[model samples]
Target: MTSLASKLTVIVSAAFEEAGLPADLGLVRVSDRPDLAQFQCNGAMAAAKVAKKNPRAVAEEVAGRLKARGEFAKVEIAGPGFINIDLTPEAIAGHLSAMATDARLSVPEMAQGETVVLDYGGPNIAKPMHVGHLRAGIIGDTLRRIMAFAGYKTLGDVHMGDWGTHLGILFNDYIRSGEQDKVLKVDLDDPASVSALFEDMSERYPRASAASKEDEALRAQAQEATLKMQNREAPYYEMWQKVKAVSIVGMERNYGMLNVHFDLWKGEADVHDLIPPMVDDLKARGYAVESEGAIVVPVKRNEDKKEVPPLLLVKRDGAFIYGSTDLATVVERMQLYGPSKIIYVVDQRQGLHFEQVFRAARMGGIAPDAVELTFAGFGTMNGPDGKPFKTRAGGVLKLEDLIAMGVAKATERLNDANLAKDMPETERASIAHKVAVAAIKFADLQNQRQADYVFDIDRMVSFEGKTGPYLLYQAVRIKSLLRKAESSGSETRGFGNTEIQKFGDSDIPLALLLCELPDVFEGALNNYTPHLLCEYAYRLAQTFSSFYNSCHILSEEDEVLRGSRLTLCTLTLAQLELVLSLLGIEVPDRM
Candidate 1:
């Protein structure tokens, strides 16, 4: 369905075109100042510049032409040269009827499709997922949902960090096999075992990474073990499999808790076999050049360096860096998925690295279209002293701990409110849990993804202001009112059997607010801004509050008036639920 703004734009364009003027001068928009009218057109100013006429005269002439048609409830020329339009009651009522029935709420889906690959939440295999991975998970998941809503074919790839130099370090440490006097071996199933393995590996890897720290025979054995694992050999591959399985299981718990799910979980190991041919192809095309003892792609460097740092495809010792493997993966994706755009949701600190990879891809001529790479930056969750967020024990905080804290606070708030004391304790607890999750998601989403925000549970769980709980509260309140009306036999009658009440006889705040739904969805889709829906939800809540306060739903003396208000309330609740759902929030029946 065409929005009111678009319809007006078309009408205005035709009016000017009929007058022998360019159509570009015609534009319509929601009013910046609501006191003037519902909509305002600045086309007179643009038209006057080309028509060689006075601006006020042009506006006056257009207003007269529109006035003769009687399409607007009120039409006037204001200021220097603007046409203000007040939609008639009939027009608003008609539009609202159309919106109430339209399932998409006038938000159009894309007619042309684009393929997108979103790479996010790149966590190493041996390490615990931390706050550092938060932004990628949230932002990328949100983007995936938005793009799908916009009618695009989107694939979310959790590019697991499974293969890298870290493999070599782990291999060396395991092969040492000396002084193995511990009575119990590390178990991957237990959290403590997993934690200790990571802690011990982190402490030992840097020392073993040095050339002089190990004998030639030990280094050779390490390399052999690394190759065996990569080739899926027995014992070595079995051990690596256990590590990958355990880590992935742990990571899935985090994603599930966050309401994040990936369409694909392709790992670096999946592309390892293709790396050799990719390097050969680069050599054949001269994109790979011999530099020093290693094969590299010589890149431009800063003024401080006399020699440009090569991409380092092959180390002097014939080892592949991540850059080479990534280049190979790009080729594989181009062949397998054939995406129009590739969006990497990696960290902003890797900006230079993506630049190198993109340049190398263009040089390789593997893609017919330019690959679009996007980087998202995140700030640390700071403590009271403004450093990285940490526990009272001065250790890194786990993602689970943060979620648990938010839920605990939300439960406390629910108990304090004493909401639904009649309901079972189990049900109340479940409702509280949902509220907590919604609160955390809403707080994280309200801010711009690029900026860092303080995750305050107290502020987030409040049932007032622009918080998620506030929106949820409004929804539950509407449901409560409707349920009350239903029990009292005051629910809205079918439209055909009901008489539409006069607009001026009662408050029309909800009607006024209803006009903004199409505008809100349009803004969100175009700008990729869910906050637009957040604002719309808050306004709808505020409008409902005003209506509830000033007017009586069940106490109305006239049947039609009460019925109309009931209809309005029902529609308002539907819209509130719709917009909140789009923001990835759900409203509980009570509280």
Candidate 2:
């Protein structure tokens, strides 16, 4: 199952050693100029610097050694020292046969038993999810899928903002609005009651927060309520639980629509108890000091080019802040999971905040040096005007509303294309949902994580061009082709037959691209970039389209050629499905 490029590197590396040159200078990659070669090795250029010999002379020596192996059809020196290699048709057929039989499509499991923890989903308890939460969920979920596929044990945590002064604000609002009787009488098991209570609370919260800024007395009442909840006072504690329960139900529904799930639904409140001891440990170890009346962890270093403020652990009133809970969450995760790496997928704007937290963790000896803490920061999703996305009315659009808009647009596109009109209404609806989800996820993931992207649903849902729907359509086309082949009794299972007489010009490019799938996975996993996979999927689909249009499969008189072409189609479909699945996109069997 070794990739063709890797196999070639091994052969060439041995050649370098046999020729009395450094074996490390034998790196081989897919040729940038496919018009001349299928693979290229520029190692001779670097080797010339070490051996003080002519690069062309070194390349000539390597080429001579390679020609004797018979694996390549052409071993010629191009330019000054570049080695251009063309594998024989038999060699390409051999590798394709092996890939067709392997279950993992020749991609190896690189991470084995390593453990990774992925943190995302930063929605607060009382508020609904907006477009701001979209990138983190999509990117983090894709990374988890990629890591798990690479053979790592990944733990995805929602890490919600369930505990804060916001809860106290909501509670104070509930009391002042004369709805205290509703909190006492509401049954948590009744969905109607819970839904109504949350709706009312959601509406009142903004009013309360705005009023608190103007009314000193109202602000003090909110502060007192916050203290009571933190202290676990009877009435406040009960109210907090009710609010948490109602909020989680709504949160799950919204997240479910996006097909985003988490193994840990933990939040700041989960680590509240650990904060006191963590702060005490930091203070005792001299990692924390009192700044005024508040406890803080001074993380600034002498080497820092810019000033970094201390991580606030406790406010002057003895209430914990976000840094305290985040630090405690790290301790909890390490104690429970013992992960080798913990990755935070948050907004890039919070880069300074994470820098301080990671530094403090290292200085306090809480996160061991062996464990890596990574901040996979991402940029914002903007509107057409190059600002953060908002509704037409300038309000933050809820995540569900955005999804609905996509689905509605997708349905309209389906109708315009006159697709799936004969299917049952339920099936067509399912296809639209899948298409919508794919469009939204792909539009977000296709951009580099650190770059801002415009959210355009119209462009994303198109069935042509580099869109998710286009990929899905191509996959469905392959499935239709396979069905026709089966009906005509064409041999589809003998992909291992290497006795084919010839390969179409287009066939080789598609096959060569198939061999690069593992390398693409490696690049994305190492760099934490899902857009690499997106680019690969698009190119693969486009390549297959060219191959299909040019190569005659069902009408070919040669049985061997027909079978070979069918095998290529089958492999392309499987790879397309695999890449899309890694991006958390679902492909319907028909649409």
Candidate 3:
């Protein structure tokens, strides 16, 4: 079914065409003023500006055309240029009923599906994931789920950082301790503890780095070991593999807790061999040149300006930078999947870095014109003090600790509410875990991805306001009623497939809101923002509350009216679940 806005746009477009004007100006959108109208066409003013006529006159002309059609119950031309529209009650009810039984819920899929490569969950090999990693993983996972639900064949890659100088720093620390043979052995059966190794490196790597600054010989030794590891020397390569295998255990644990997964664990080191060839191709194609003894791919934001420097592919000392690995990764993705779109979810701080990468890729013809490269940048999380979140010790907050903290807060709230006190221990454990994860994920996703949001466990797990727990509570409440209906043998067919020929005064508002889901969903998908879906879900739950409180469903004297209200409850629960899934939020069966 076409959206109401789309249908109105078609009608208005014809009017614009008949008036010998640009039809594009006749786009119809949801009215900003709810008390004024359900929908509005503001094209009159834009068209009037172009046609050199009065906006009110243009609106009157459009209103006359709209009135000739009997779909709308009221067609009013407000002051200046706005045309307010309210669909007939029958129209709204018919659309909503059709949506209830439709498998896809009247949300159309993309016209043609494309192969997509999504890069996210980028935790380096040695370091622990922090709240900063939380933002990228959550946003990228939601986008992946939404795009896949809309029929795109997507590949989620972790894009690990296993091949950088960070490895060398750790290696230097390991070798200087004089336990080289014992540590170099690859224990694939039972990997070494990553946290233990990280602790060791955390203490010693800085000292090694500091001593290397004053000692050129030590620096040279580190560089030599890095080269040997890259060149696949027996001892260094085995140690490298061991480090990679163990580090991934911690990485996967964090991802599993967040319900995030990657189809490919390809790291920067995976494309190491490809970089030399790529650099050679760039030089041959005249897209790269030698600058300060380093091979570089020059990128400029403006043709007349050269503020930002070029991307360094190879350092003078013969080492590949992260940018080089990124370029090789593009070529690798193109060779394997030939995706139409490659989306990167990273920090907004990396805006310039991605710009440099994409431009360099396009200049070198690594990304073809048909391939669309998009970087969805997100803001950082902050503490209540409005600074970047850190531990009391002024260290980075580990993601695992954050999860544990969320669960603790949720459990306290759940106990305080005295909910499910007699439930089995296993069920309560499951609820606590789900609520904790939901609180963390929802708190991050409820705001626009580009805007920094304060991290607060209390607010997130609260049962009131626009919190994840509240949405879950609403769903659980509906389930309780539906169970009650089943026990009483009350017919609920009114909610499944039956169309309403009439509505109570209180039902019209919800019916209208339900009809706008397709438009809201489409907008959210196009804008690459899940917060919009959060908004629709919250407003829907709020409306359902009003409907439940004021109108009697299970206790109504009129059987047909009661069944209709039951159906409304069922549809609300379904839409709420669908949006929550889109946002990657979990709803418990019980509060």
Highest lDDT scorer: 2
- Give the range of the ten consecutive residues with the poorest summed lDDT in model 1: 491-500
Q: How well does candidate 2 score on lDDT at residue 497?
A: 47
**What is the alpha-carbon lDDT of model 1 when measured against the actual structure?**
0.70
Candidate 3 lDDT by residue in tens digits, 306-373: 47779989987888888899889999999999999999988888888888899999998899988999
- Give per-residue CA lDDT, model 2, range 1-591, as digits (tens): 667898899999999999899998898999999999999999999989999989999999999999998788999898989999999988988888788888898999998778899998888887777888999999999999999999999999999997788878878877777776666667889999998887777677777899998999888888878878888886777888887888889878887888887889999999989999999999998999999999999999899999999999998888888899889999999999999999999999899999989998999988999999999999988889999887788877778887888889878876776666677889888888998888888888999999888876567555568888888989999998888877766654433343434577778999899899988999999999999999999999899988888877778776777778878888899999999999999899877
lDDT of each: 0.70, 0.87, 0.80
lDDT against true structure, model 2: 0.87
Ranking the candidates on lDDT from highest down gives 2, 3, 1
Q: Count the backbone clashes (under 3 Å) in each candidate.
A: 0, 0, 1
In angstroms, give how far residue 306 of model 2 lies from its true place: 2.4
lDDT of 1 by residue, 468-493 (tens): 77778877887888787778766444
TM-score (all chains, Cα) for each model: 0.83, 0.95, 0.93
